[model samples]
Target: MVKKSVRNKAISSVLGTVIVLAITIALGGLLYAYSQGMFSNLTQNTNINVQAKIIVNPSTNDSYLQLTLVNNGNLGINITKVTIDSNGISIPINVYLPPGQQYSNTFPLTSKMIAGETYTVTVYGNSNNKPVVETMNVLASTV
Candidate 1:
């Protein structure tokens, strides 16, 4: 009677191990399928036209004005960085870009323009030589 009970227990253990192994293998196959599709997700099928709307930076008496940009693209974009120049002053801006997003930038008004002088702050992109949009005739005050 004792020998019979021990053999039955051993058999039960072997069956439980087999069931666990089968379940693990099935779940492994499911996970592998999901991993393959995740990379192809979020891809845009349409053409992307990058249009940027320049938002001029705010200016004060002690500091220069700034600008913000709106991306009107259909997909995501990697903007390199921001560069600003008008008349003679050059300004550098830290920038990041996303699809249909907006970012603000500040460019100093170091150019020797008199108070009440009007200037055009042309905003250009890193990818293209052309300006996406230009904020022209901004009111400048020397104060």
Candidate 2:
């Protein structure tokens, strides 16, 4: 009787160990699959970043141009230079862009401009050493 009880107990212990190991393997496989899906989606959506439209308020004179720079990129705008081309005119604007922040830039004019003339503002970007250019259209009609 003693021998039979010992044998049965040993068999039960072996069966319990096998069952627990199987459960562990199954859970590990499930976790691996879940992690793979989560990481794949994260990498797929982080391609390009850009900035949004900014509000501008020109100075008291039509000869000067004021700008509000907004960082629409996932990073900083990294403005290299701000240039303006008003129908037969051209000038360089000053800029200072903070990371994920907005700043106002004021450009001094070298010539007189009309109130209803259209002007183009072009921003050159070099964040992360990669050069990019963006343009915005502005007019002197409204304040």
Candidate 3:
């Protein structure tokens, strides 16, 4: 029988190892990039809480809309505008609130509100140079 040639065995083994190492490095890079984006988004989330109600004054039988805003995020936010959907009214405001702080105010309603009725209030603002909106459904009640 003719002798088997082994001259190319070492070269083949080296080539195969290089290909596997290249593939492993490429996969590792992709995994690292994906994880970086996920962590960044988690750290940059915004959280704002809103509470609203229609308050009726017992003494005068007058009605008003009350709003309470709480900033629970890591950045400060500015209250730029507010809208009462039922009355088709928009109120422009400029209020700055820092994290862990709150702001509350009451606005007189043009018309009286019926008790047990629901109303919609929308608040618009900016936080960290990004627009933010919070909508709340409020029920009319007497104090």
Number of the top lDDT candidate: 3
Poorly placed runs, candidate 1 (over 4 Å): 1-63, 76-86, 127-135, 141-143
Sort by TM-score, best first.
3, 2, 1
Pairs that collide, model 2: 50-72, 50-73, 51-72, 51-73
- Candidate 3: tens digits of C-alpha lDDT, residues 4-56: 88665355778999999999999999889878764443465557899888888
Question: Given candidate 1, what's the lDDT at residue 116?
Answer: 61
In TM-score terms, candidate 2 sits at 0.50
Better of 2 and 3 by lDDT: 3
Give the per-residue lDDT digits (tens) of candidate 1, residues 21-140: 999999998789768855334544222232222233336334456555665554444444333344655455445456667776544545445456565555444433323433345666
Q: Is candidate 2 or candidate 3 better by TM-score?
A: 3
Question: Scored by Cα lDDT, where does model 2 land?
Answer: 0.57
lDDT of each: 0.50, 0.57, 0.84
Could you tell me which 10 consecutive residues in candidate 3 have the lowest summed lDDT?
A: 37-46
TM-score of structure candidate 3: 0.65
